[model samples]
Target chain A: MQDPFELSPSECEALLRAGVVGRIALATPTGPHIVPVNYSVVEESIVVLTSPYSLLGTHGRDSMLAFEIDQFDYEYHRGWSVVARGRAEVVTDPAEVERIRKTWPPRPWASGIRTLCLRIRWSELSGRRLGTGWQPMEDLPVHRVV
Target chain B: MQDPFELSPSECEALLRAGVVGRIALATPTGPHIVPVNYSVVEESIVVLTSPYSLLGTHGRDSMLAFEIDQFDYEYHRGWSVVARGRAEVVTDPAEVERIRKTWPPRPWASGIRTLCLRIRWSELSGRRLGTGWQPMEDLPVHRVV
Candidate 1:
């Protein structure tokens, strides 16, 4: 197996954009929590819709959060992981909401009210890929939605 | 689409035992971080091997952590997520290590000197599955290894 290599900033952003689902990690009073949600990258920030009472909607507001997206092949023993660290902001402003809506708005798979919208603006971004001579973006399981 | 339903405790334990990889969430001085790892279930505790200087090994030492394992199908819009919340303890006792080694020991796919063994004894466990009338265990991407 080839040694893993670091992904550049542009590569990480492209992967995030191509991906639809990502996991968000945050510190809650009880302990740390990780929740998977379908997201859309708008203006380089990760955006998602969740119920106001959900764990993410309740504790993720205005908190430093980590977002991760990855794809792995167990048989081939190859994969890539990208992690973004940033503060979470609840999108409430009408103007900001309009801007996000114009872009690829997030659509939650699970049925719910999902009125709350959270946007994470990452300050730190990094990624690493294992194995060799392959483009992860090309191997995405789902095609990128326009 | 059917409303998601909560999985019973026994069902959650079965899913965790069958899963080979899981994501661990922990709080660090910088922020909340999530790292994907291959793990094994021994005595209902999540055991993983990570590099000593890695994020999980360093920040997870003796800290409250959250572990999540899931499988999602984009086409069917169905999936299940199981989250385990517990305190992470580094395994150092020789006798305890021997006991764990006798069970399904964690084998990390990533190449590294993963000398640190961390065990998470969950105090809280919960899971939910979207969609209905399908067996997730049967749909597992990889067969469980003994």
Candidate 2:
């Protein structure tokens, strides 16, 4: 197998835009929590809709967060992962909410009252692709609806 | 869609034993980082073999960490996630290493010199499963070889 290679900025953005679900990593009062979230990439920021009383909604507001998305093949020992690190802020503005709703808004699959919208304006965006002869973008399991 | 229900402790443990890969969440000097690692559950503690100088090895020593594994069906918007939170310790004892090696040892898919063994003795073990009429234990993509 060829060595893993770093993904370009545009490629990372494309993967984030195409992904329907990702994991949010943040430091909680008890410990570090990695929670799965259905997210959208709006203007380079990761947008997620969660419950106000949930673990993410309770502690993720205005907190340093890491958003990760990846596609891996266990049988082949290959995959690509993109991570974005930034501070998250709650979207309280009415206009901003309307705009997000109009764009590629986050559609959570679970049944719950998920009105809280958290946006992570990433300061660092990076990704790595392992294995060779295959493009990471083409291997996405779920395609985002544009 | 049905509301998500809490998984029993036995169910959580079964899923962990069956899973082949999971993500590790921990706090770093920069921020929270989530990295995927091939892991095995040995006596209810998560065991991972990583590089001595990797992120997990550098900051995960005696540090509180969270490990998560899940399987999701994007089309049906249903899935299950299990998380374990605890302090991680590096296994340096030769006898302990021998015992672990005989058991289900971690097999990292990526090419690297992963000699460092970090074990997280989880204090909290919990999980949630969404959807109905399905078993999370039967949904794993990669089954662990016993």
Candidate 3:
């Protein structure tokens, strides 16, 4: 089997910044919930614009949340994944929210009044890459048999 | 702004069946965690193969979990997302596991010993689509000003 490799902190941060969409995980009284969102990286924090009544915006405030982004190449069997664990906070300060809007605006793909900006300052950032080592040769028994 | 639309249960199931990859959300002692995984739908349950010691394999068993899949088109601003919420169970029955393997095997993109098969029978399935309504005319004031 091939082995996966770990990515450095800087690499993780770069990937997070480059990502356009990600999944945010939140724990609620009902259960664990996950939803996709368009996001932007600003000042080393992940910012997402959402409706205050939405699932993410409602349960995410002051709660521990996880954000993840990944890309996979099916034919090449190569991929990279990044995960960020942090606490979700509402950007209440109008000045700060406006600054974020001007610099790196979070645009929701789904149309709605996304006036509330949620910021997640990750306490932990980690990433991994798949198919980085020891690809099975075509002539190998495993490949030939399969 | 364009309005988002809700998808029916049948539409949600069809989307889930068509998806090959999804994110699974789990609540742990540390926080809410989300990770991508290759999966297959069988008997109306989502199945995934993973290592017994991995975060998902270990904590996912008997836990309330959330599974999500989505697709987005940036140019047209169109997309659909589906979410499945349920409790995870380990597929320990040899015959059942073999049947699932034959029908739709879970192939992990990341290299690992993926011997354990877990199934999540979702109690709730929901979906939504974006950019399905009226589109603002490009020659309108909002477009011209921007």
**Quality class of the docking in candidate 2, CAPRI style:** medium
Candidate 1, residues A1-146, lDDT tens digits: the string is 43688999999999998888889999999889999888999987999999889999899999999999988888887889899989999999999999999978986778888899999998999998888879998898885577
For model 3, the superposed segments whose C-alpha errors exceed 4 Å read: A133-146, B133-146
What digit string (tens of lDDT, one per residue) describes model 3 on residues A1-146?
34678878887887787667788999989889988888888897899999899898789999999999876655666667799999989999999988997888776667778878899999999987777543222111111000
Compared with the true structure, all predictions reach lDDT values of 0.89, 0.89, 0.80
Checking candidate 1 for backbone clashes, the offending pairs are none
DockQ of 2: 0.67
Q: After superposition, how far is residue A21 of candidate 3 from its true place, in Å?
A: 1.5
Compose the digit string of candidate 2's lDDT tens values, residues B74-135.
88889999999999999999988988899878877778888899999989999999899888
Can you tell me the CAPRI class of model 3? Answer: acceptable
Candidate 2, B4: how far from true, in Å? 1.1
Candidates in descending DockQ order: 1, 2, 3
Q: Model 1: residues >4 Å from true position, as ranges?
A: none
DockQ of 1: 0.68
